[model samples]
Target: MTEQEELVICVPGQRLCVADKSNVAGAGTYEQQGYIYSKLAGIVKLVTDDKTRTVEVHSITEQSIVPAPGDIVTAMVTVVNQRFCKCSIKCVGDIVLTRPYRGILRKEDVRAIDKDKLEMYKCYRPGDIILARVMPMTEIHSYQLSTAENELGVVIAHSDEEIRQMMHGFGDSSEPLFESAKIIEDVVLQQMKIIVRRACEIADRRANSKKSNIINGEDLLFLLRKDKIRLQRIVKYLELKELGCSVQKLMTANDVPQNVTDPEQLDIKKKVPFQSFLEQIDNTGELLENSSSVDDVKRRRCIRADIASKSMDEVHYMKFSKARRVSFANKNRHKFSDWICADGDVTVSKQAYTILSYLAYETVAQIVDLAFLVRQDQGKMHGDAIDRQRLNYINPFTFKPRYHSKNFVMKPLTPSEITEALRRYWSPQLDMTGPFNRWSMRRPHLKLLSC
Candidate 1:
């Protein structure tokens, strides 16, 4: 009721909506009246135009674009295929069992205890109602739907074929049904809670770290911190060793090149406490002359350039690792998507993969025959598996089947590794400076996620 809330008041004279955009061509429609909605609860986020009036609407929390692993959904059974029963989702993103959606209840994931006893017909007849959960969204953008709860069954249905047929196309079907699907909504909701609660428990058990287990900015930060520290140590240690050796070569050289011995360029004249040695040698010239020999200044070859060039491999290694962290985070959150309840044959998720771990999957996998053999020959590559191993082949956010079981995973890495990897990853590309947390992760890698 705040004054700042923009609302469309019904004009006293107009029967239908009329706005600037409406007169241009055709902006509004009677079929989509829910376009105008209250500020508090409304499913419709987009408004066609300024002329549309806003009204108080209701929304049942359920499955949405970014569903967690255990969020339950309500759906109406649509197609009964050989291995699965497709349904139309009435609820999305959250755990709303009142409004269902279209989903495919796969034959295998039909029940909680004994899946073999699940006869598709007994479980659900066409046009029957159902309750399911967001198990996993496939890369192809289909909801890997499941009705694995004791009470997650048909909630509402209309036995009369003609009435149900009319209802399908009707804008609103609040009328009482032959088999009141509304009555079963609460029951489905009850069972959905139990099932979802249990599913969360299972996810928690599978989680390795509280931070790593849940996909967010905090986990990214943790991983980056660890990686950065280790990388810094490696870089600093290498540089220190290289510098130390250069000074050592300068101190004990008989005929090193003048250019190579340039103190300004070579950094070989670092202040050393060698005055005592010089004084001792000068005072005891006879003893020093006897001790110092031609062999002492025989000009040993310098290995500074060789060592520095060899360390460049660290950059390649780190780049792949950086992408892998993004990939890993993407893989970990792969199960969480808005695409879960979408059509498989067509569009999947509305978004793209937010991680880059799977970027060079095929190319890298090709080089490593052992990896290729394991995935191609044995054929056990899956997104979940890649997430467990932190591989990069497919972007995990969108539902594209091609990236699902990307067959490459660079190993010896875990969720903690992504943090340090981001410094090298995000640092090189964009000047984004923030904790490598969930928010930071959600922040696209500018060039990587732009467009």
Candidate 2:
């Protein structure tokens, strides 16, 4: 081919011009069986002189490069062990490679002196960038590397903990500070941008799933909840925000008169009247009754007496105890007499009857809450009642008749059967197993029991 001729593109192993005295194989080409064949998928070129011609194949793009013997390469250590360190060659000589090639550095090839005493971990670590000379290809698709020379070893080394500390502005002061204030600021800004981008992506995905465009605070809260430590702070902040209070005010506010009109200004240490405490309880009950959101239900359930005391006062504590006693007396007034004269032989005290009634109410309330949660998890609306199967699952106390049995009787479980059921369902945790075992032993003769 002449310089004026049309360009001929040839792939590897494709036959080109015949090999003769006037034509010879050049770079990217090989002479085989009296024919010049292309060794690379590129354009075939011909170089002519007065005596002979050299046929070659040149790539359509930049010249193809690979790490060859004695060529220096930059590699990032992927793994390091006692025997060898594995890395991926990122650059050949001064040229950055488009794709990484596998390289291995044995412990013996790490340094020239004391090769036998050299430890791979001491010389290099994972994520370390190192310079090494390519020895030769020993295995398929992998290059043998060596850093025995004085100037070829770990060029950059930073442990994960070091990187984390640097990111948090707590890096070691002993080391030379190469990073400037601007660089630190830029890194922080870039990190914030990434976090914001990730949060937006999550919110957008959730909104898309709901077939909506508006992302709400709940989505951001969901993201925060993924980090358990941050979740607690976020929850506290939200609770304080909802109550129209701040942490500083809550900490510094003094005990004031109960006559304070604004709830936010009310002193947590001030004594709350019995009537006011009762009113708060009634309001809480009303809120629970009218709650439509599952989150509202959860929030209400998390309200503890101690947490409420933080906003109210110690006077409410005594009032709360008295109110509970009064409520229990009113609820079991009629049943107290029946419980005392039960079967004309057994007698039950008012306190015992009240305790039983309180336990029964608590269990029923918990079952109701669990049923609502199960229905919500099933993608049901607030108005939707729990299905029969789910209701049975939530309230295991419900009698499920064994219709398939020969004696299909509708009866309550015996004491032994109840104990067995409790043992089977309850996990072997201290709180659960200790109480259960003690209760079972104390009431081994009881006819019926409900968890």
Candidate 3:
């Protein structure tokens, strides 16, 4: 049978493969002298690229989110110096992120055309909202930011009330014909009133449809959002309405199930299976007896003799002289190194290679990778395509792959296709340090592979 009959749990320092040049290491693994080893406790996976004929490990886990190079970020300037300015990243791409990512914008990166002549003060001040692209990570604490492009720069500036008053002064004039700015503001106000009125009407209609007498703040907010109101403004308006109430109190009350809060009142005991629990309790004594059998004089002697004979027979294979008699402490400390038999009837040596192969394959498959693939089918391209209205997900009403670019021309590969693509595209370049970054940096190829 081929490898990967079952999942294998790998631990740090476990050998994955005898490093040949063909075997390239992926994440959660490192290569040593002619051998590939794991660096994290995870599953092992090995992928073969058709073009490159290379193998690499893949690691999967929930990793801390951080801003990476080339990502467009929205940040607020916190500090400024002659050479560099410091800012806190508030958003990455379209996500409003938290847990502060510090960024630095150098004077040279402030503008594209001017380098030496650029002044930091003229470009930015503390509290200025700047849009920047992440530069190569230079240090651990802060990310390097560049506003060198036309679209990347101070999107909002911290202006004093005096400037605000001056800007709004045109609307104060009692003159029959005000300035162009006042006329534009009046038109915008009229449009905004109409939109808000429409949104309220929609909310009322929805409440009526639900047979509800009153529309809550949530209903109003949802209707407003559907009408294309800014999320931040909508949230602020909701906050203003609920100013006297404790939002946290309401959230907590909703989170805890009613049955859990008053189990007796809910008659939860009747719903629970008492027979299974009683059976478990009855078996606990038998389990304790079996565990204590290790302390039995006869069993202890038998185990010692068996271990002694095995160790003597395999003396030459022992890496350390002291391993001839392995201590219980050593075994306990190195429990992660203990192997489970893939084929229970056979000795470890006969099935060791098979087990290792499975671990490698699993490791490669688990680590998720992002890839752009061309849409192979033309079924979804038509204007009246039924697929367009089909819900991508059951819970969230957003389109499938929620984090895609707006008007994104490229289609992301499906999960099923990714496995084969990884196998087909497994190349030595993927073994390079920062392989994922390398993949992203390169121009995405349009040559699609079929499953």
TM-score versus the correct structure, for each prediction:
0.22, 0.32, 0.27
Q: Please, what are the lDDT tens digits per residue for candidate 1 over residues 1-451? A: 3325454332211233232333221211121232221212223223334664332222334222323245576677876666788878766533343433345678988877777766775566666766677674563445677776776766764233222222211111213132422222222223323322333343354464331223321211122232333222223333454566786786587755557646676755454222233343344343213232332101110121122123335543344333322311244334323212222332222111221122112112211212222333233444455442332322222211121233222222121222233233334333344354434434332222100
Candidate 1 ranges beyond 4 A from true positions: 1-67, 93-102, 158-451
TM-score of 1: 0.22
**Candidate 2 error regions (>4 Å):** 1-41, 44-57, 61-64, 161-451
Query: Higher lDDT: candidate 1 or 3?
Result: 3
Measured over all alpha carbons after superposition, the RMSD of each candidate to the real structure, in angstroms, is: 25.7, 25.1, 36.2
Clash tally for model 2: 0
Candidate 2 structure quality by residue, lDDT tens digits, 1-451? 5567668987756888789999877877766668877756788777888988888888887655466667799999998889998999998777787678899998888888888887776678676899999885689778899998988988876433222222111111112122322232233233323333344555567666543333334433344333333333334433443344433454466755445545555544322222232244343344213334344323433342223233323553444444333322344445433322233432334433333333233332333233223433343333324343222232222212233323222222123332233333332332334455645433222211121
Instruction: Score each candidate by Cα lDDT.
Output: 0.36, 0.50, 0.43
Model 3 per-residue lDDT tens digits across residues 335-419: 2112211223222221222222222222221211111111212223223233322211111111122223231111323434433
Q: Could you say which candidate leads in TM-score? A: 2
The stretch of ten residues in a row with the least summed lDDT in candidate 1 is: 296-305
Superior candidate under lDDT, 1 versus 2 = 2
In model 2, the Cα lDDT at residue 301 comes to 36
